[model samples]
Target: MELEIYQVDAFAEEVFSGNPAAVIPLYEWLSDELMQHIAEENNLSETAFFVRKGEYFELRWFTPETEVDLCGHATLASAHVIYEFLDYTDQAVVFETKSGRLFVDRDNGRYSMDFPAWGVREIQVTERVSDALGVRPDLLFMGKRDMMAVFEDEQTVRDLKPDFAKVVQLDGVCMICTAPGLDYDFVSRTFVPEEGILEDPVTGSAHCTLVPYWAARLGKDSLIAYQASRRGGVLECANLGDRVKIAGQAVTYMKGTITL
Candidate 1:
């Protein structure tokens, strides 16, 4: 069997400005071992696989190391592949993932995704966290992926030099150091050494937590967010009822076929 694959950079207008995700639209569900092997070979932070199932598609995400329950940028990239390459002309596309039913809207030169709003809970910072980050946070919170650390300013968040080895043991998928941006409304940087990614270029999942937190703090429902990764990512965020809509751009870098 020949399987088609697409490599897309999600959340950036340019080809390589955002996080890269491999979108593999599969004809059928392959064995878990094979999927893992494919992802390992790809060596990307996340590889998305999807199979059409009626009106929706069953989507799954895998890292080079293991499968994950949810991935935001990869999901966005999958939507981009379906719209741009799979001949999907509709204005909207829906993907039924392990997390839940995710919907993507394509319009006005941007792609918007309605994803689950992961409610974050406030927590106290410990010596371990302080030592790992090499700095102190004014406020700390817990989310699905990582511990949310609110810094004094954008510089503090950008200046973070966390001990990745220790951060891997602290907890969650990654550590988010965020503050109000000087240019944009908010800025964040995610560190996920545990997920085999040192710094996720632009983490949409992290914004699920950041959007709500900043929305409540800033008393606004909409925001412009910037991820301070080396590659960088820009996102327009909005908080909905029990859901968060993250919008960004995706550019296809490579597309090819894989013989299976």
Candidate 2:
């Protein structure tokens, strides 16, 4: 079978600036093994596959090693494919995912994603956490699927060189290191060696947990954020009552055919 595939730089205004996700739109679901193989072959942080289901679409995300419950960058990339490549005219697209129904809206050349906010509880920092990050954060919070480590400043977040070998042993999807930003409201860096992504340049899902944390801490509902990875990315963020809005621009990097 020959399938159409697209590579999009999510949360970036141009190529080589944001997290790259592989998106494949399917008429029907393919075998899980095959999809996993495809994602492994693509070798991106996440590969998104979708099948049209009436007015909505069913979406799944896979890393090089495993399928995940939620992924923000890939979902944004999928919406980009639908709106820009598939000739979708609607202002927004809703995707049914393992996490739940995710909504992406397009306006003024930016895509805003409405995703569920994850609740957090304070966690005592352990030796493993310090060993993994090589820097101890002032505060630690545990979310449903990820951990938030709050540092004192942006430079600390940018200078971190994680011990991925140790980080992979932590019991979470990824370790999020964040600090107050100089230009934006906050900044972060994500490490997920177990998911085959050492550092995600831009993470939309991480912001779901971040938006709420920062909003309550900073006393604001709307804020701007930056991911301080090497490639870097910017996001316009907002914290709703139970949901968070992550807004950014995506650019098409490549379009090709996948043969199986």
lDDT of each: 0.90, 0.94
Expressed as tens digits, the lDDT of each residue in 1-260 for candidate 1 is 88899999999899879999999998889999999999999999999999999788899999888898888899899999888888888778888887889999898658999987877898998988998899989889998766899987999888888999888988788788999999999999998888788888899888888898899999999899999988999999998958999999999999998887
lDDT of 2 by residue, 160-204 (tens): 998999999987888999999999999999999988999988999
Q: Estimate each model's TM-score.
A: 0.97, 0.99
Candidate 1 regions off by >4 Å?
none
The residue-level lDDT of candidate 2 at 91 comes to 73
Candidate 2 total steric clashes: 0
Q: Assess candidate 2 and give its lDDT.
A: 0.94
The residue pairs found clashing in candidate 2 are: none
Worst 10 residues of 2 by lDDT: 83-92
